[model samples]
Target: MTTTATTAKDLFLTAMDRRFAPEVGQGDLSLALAGAELLDLLGARALTLDGDRVVPGAAAALGDVLLDEASAALVRQPPYEQVEDWLWRRGRDLAAAYRRALQADGGLSARRSGRLGLGAVRVEPVDSPARERAAARLEAAEPVLGALAAAIGIGIAADTEAGQAAVPAAAALEDEPVTTVLAAVMDAVMELEAVRRRRSIEEAAFANIWRAP
Candidate 1:
């Protein structure tokens, strides 16, 4: 299993493994993935956190297209993008983008099955070194990755007692930059939940009004 890859890629593969789980939102996953990219970049010293604002370092080709693209996408000017803002902007439809990238790279596959019946296809992870490496990290509770996966409500999370117990790796991530990204991911998830709930309530109220003739 290859250890050298984007954390977001690892997290994405792990999440898709739990694809049948309930309440896993694509938008939230996207946000978490974006945060993962930042975390990975921080680890590479490709960038650093100036408080919540991201300060870009010297450009480096990260050997991964997505990671390189993420580096290039950084706001180079003053008053650079904050963690939360970067999450929303980069997270937009990011889940699908990741899926496409992975599928193209043969990290993911679509199999037509009877589950959805007829032409239904299910996307599954290929038996690749990348997938194996990600599973190993999750299995070992690798701190940043475990924390990132959990933030998206996949694998283990702080919300679960076992997740809390399992992640000594999570505890290892005590540095300011790591904590900053993790906290921002959690906040973004909460905000996304609030948005979903608000829309649900609004739709229900609208239906009530429509029926109130």
Candidate 2:
């Protein structure tokens, strides 16, 4: 069976192939995948962001289970949540799910092993011409794919170099509705990151300030 990538989720999974580490916190990867999924839906006109809310667009299927599920979730839920909130809340083990899906599609291989004396699984891409082509396409900054790459880069800024390179390219794209939306999403995610960092620092300071007398 020839494995192919047709949606942003697929492309993101391909980019993540052999790159994700089990030691890394899942939250960053999950949010990054969520960001990629959102961009894919936006590129497909499946969803749109109005201010902070995610406005549902056409419900046409994208033939990718992850993208379809994300679309359905947006469609079924009210547009009361901001994109960042929705993403953080909904993002969970997204990278793992996509990797397993890719493995099932013959696009990747997985093996169980022990890491740091703990059980762990390692996944790598399978040899496939279609997979290579998809990876190349992702490497090249192509419209929706480029935007999705940028979103992932922004989402996991501290985790990977790919995200670092994606931000400028995504920001440099010509102005369009989708580009605008991508920029907004990036800003929202960044703001959330900032807030998280600040809260962590504040919590640490409080703990230190309340040390036993």
Candidate 3:
């Protein structure tokens, strides 16, 4: 299938657009986007990981601003840092940056609405074919492509059968460490989502803690 997605961010967003609700929480998608960025860097040979530490590879610009920024950050660092620390701190921002980039690229469309005098905005795919092609690519089952599809499927919809089917293929990727780190990143994303859910519940409880007696 032909696709416009030349980078991991494009594929990640495309997958989200295809499978998730239009109003999916930004925090949840952000975690996936961050994982996509890391995967792109690793795929491009612009970065590498030493054990749990991410190391800079050859200096090269990915052209995409968010990717370039990530590459530059890795290069500026001494040599390496724990993957967990770097991912947790940088993932959300990277996701936001990619969203902006998507808007500029005309791959995403924004909509505005109001209900009961309250305003809301949301983003969705501008072109359906882009996402369809991305989904087809995910099913291609090539080493890198399959690994990516599995990692992303796990991150966003591990409870679903599709996600489960993608899992075993991840082990077949040439870089075993990449699969390991990708799993770690997915775990971090799940952790962040859990935290968000807890925070929301806590806030709701607090808001109703002192009801009118």
Candidate 4:
């Protein structure tokens, strides 16, 4: 499983493209990105799954800078972090981190618009082998990526008009660890949505009380 392209990176690319998964909220996308990193760590043999807990293996400097950072951040002790816990901890603002990393590597380019072409800048992915590979994976509906993308509302329908996978990609995965991570990501994402809804309701209620006076 010596993969050069990372799931996190692919997820970022997909997020950037409006055609892939538009309307994805940052919180859910961040959780999925963290899950993607964890999956890559599993593939790289830098970590192993003990039940739903993540067990750190030997610290390896995975060639990607952000991945190496993820490896260094692993909980290297007994009572290792649970998959759900890891998603919350590592997933906080993870999307912005990937965006910055990609911009640094020229993987992203900002295009400005206006009469003088200097108004708001829209960030887009650059042409690179990494992006090409990620696009290929999405189009082919590679299970791990398809499941992750699906978790964040990006569907296999992005690839096919029939939108018929027979079964959902996540349910169809044979890889237990990958499946576990995907499930955790989905749960965390749902939890995040619930939290946002609660906050929004509370805010609205508070505003209404002030208006009543």
Candidate 5:
């Protein structure tokens, strides 16, 4: 595959904003961690020597991010390259599902293969090969998204509890543990930001590269 110089960064960003960040509640910490996982998936895909097989190491690594213990075990049993392909296909299907769900919820508007709407969201071509390749990345993201959402939910719950609690200062901080807990929250936020930056740079570079006469 001929990877354009900016594809990694560009796609990373798009995935972050259009998919990952919202799940993480738009925090920098969440984004950074998520970005790590996202980059790992993309990197694994980029390293495939055989298009037909899963790279075991890559699959295992990415699998750790996407699946819990039982699911991870199943992913590890397959040939690495094949597993990679499977994950990619799975992600693509899930991504399409996610998009459809979003449209249904009215979180997104219907559009074809270009930027549209007030937010300048670049809608991926529904049936494009690029989406096929992106599927694995999206699939891998499923777990991460769930984890991030859960973590934020926990955080929000804690905040609500803290607000409701009438306690001494020490007791309140101890019960909430916002300082320690916020670390994970922040990690999620940062991962999203990194992905966003990576995508923007990549998209701009891709345009410039392709436009050169």
Candidate 6:
């Protein structure tokens, strides 16, 4: 039976929520199992029954047309059965690291770390002559934007509320540009922009990686 696209989207989001939501601890085994079940349904295994024996095959028939290398790799394995569970395990491990970072700094620095990882994985390597030129253009634009943001006194505190609330405790002169309330707001905005870009990249990579098989 074919699973609805809506169902797949729900499963994907549920998996993300369980794995990444900071308030939630590492996802439990049950959550992992549920995620696996959703993948199974979508993978559309053709199961055959012979008395008490059951066999699963035709794994690719169930998914969409865009299977990223990561997702495709899962299908090629024998226990195509455990693909979702494998994904859950990897996801949980990633989440655990982010949680630890947040717990330590109470900031969103982990989000930046996540971006670096995604960019490393998703940005295709190319030797084309135009590639270097394009990269140079992008890099050149960074300072312009960074300077603009910095000029506005954007002091990106990873955990703005937590960090800002601690700022007033300092007995030193509060006249520093970075110490102003506006600086705190700009810092929060920078952190927010970083998080938004990182999340967008991650989600896009996820979709690209898991496009139908």
Q: How would you encode candidate 1's per-residue C-alpha lDDT over 1-213 as one tens digit per residue?
A: 222478999888887774323446789989998999999899899999999999999998888888888899999999899999999998899888888989888889888868566676667788888888888787677788878877877674446555565567688776999999999999999999999999999999999999996
Model 6 spans with C-alpha error above 4 angstroms? 1-8, 12-23, 26-39, 46-56, 59-71, 75-213
TM-score of each: 0.89, 0.64, 0.73, 0.90, 0.24, 0.23
CA deviation > 4 Å runs, candidate 4 = 1-4, 113-120, 156-162, 166-169
* C-alpha lDDT of all candidate models, in order: 0.84, 0.61, 0.62, 0.84, 0.36, 0.33
Clashing pairs in 3: none
Instruction: Please provide, for model 4 over 13-113, each residue's C-alpha lDDT reduced to its tens digit, 9 standing for 90 to 100.
Output: 87776567656788888999999999999999999999999999998788888898889999999999999999999999998898888888888888886
Model 1 ranges with Cα > 4 A deviation:
1-4, 19-23, 113-120, 156-165
Candidate order by TM-score, highest to lowest? 4, 1, 3, 2, 5, 6
Instruction: Kindly report which residue stretches of model 3 are placed more than 4 angstroms away from their true locations once superposed.
Output: 1-7, 15-23, 112-119, 128-130, 141-165, 204-209
Model 2 whole-model lDDT (C-alpha atoms): 0.61
Candidate 2: stretches off by over 4 Å: 1-4, 18-25, 75-79, 112-120, 143-169, 175-177, 184-213
Q: How many backbone clashes does candidate 1 have?
A: 0
Cα lDDT over the full model 6? 0.33
Per-candidate alpha-carbon RMSD to the true structure? 3.1, 5.3, 4.7, 2.9, 15.2, 23.0
Model 3 sits at a Cα RMSD from the real structure of 4.7
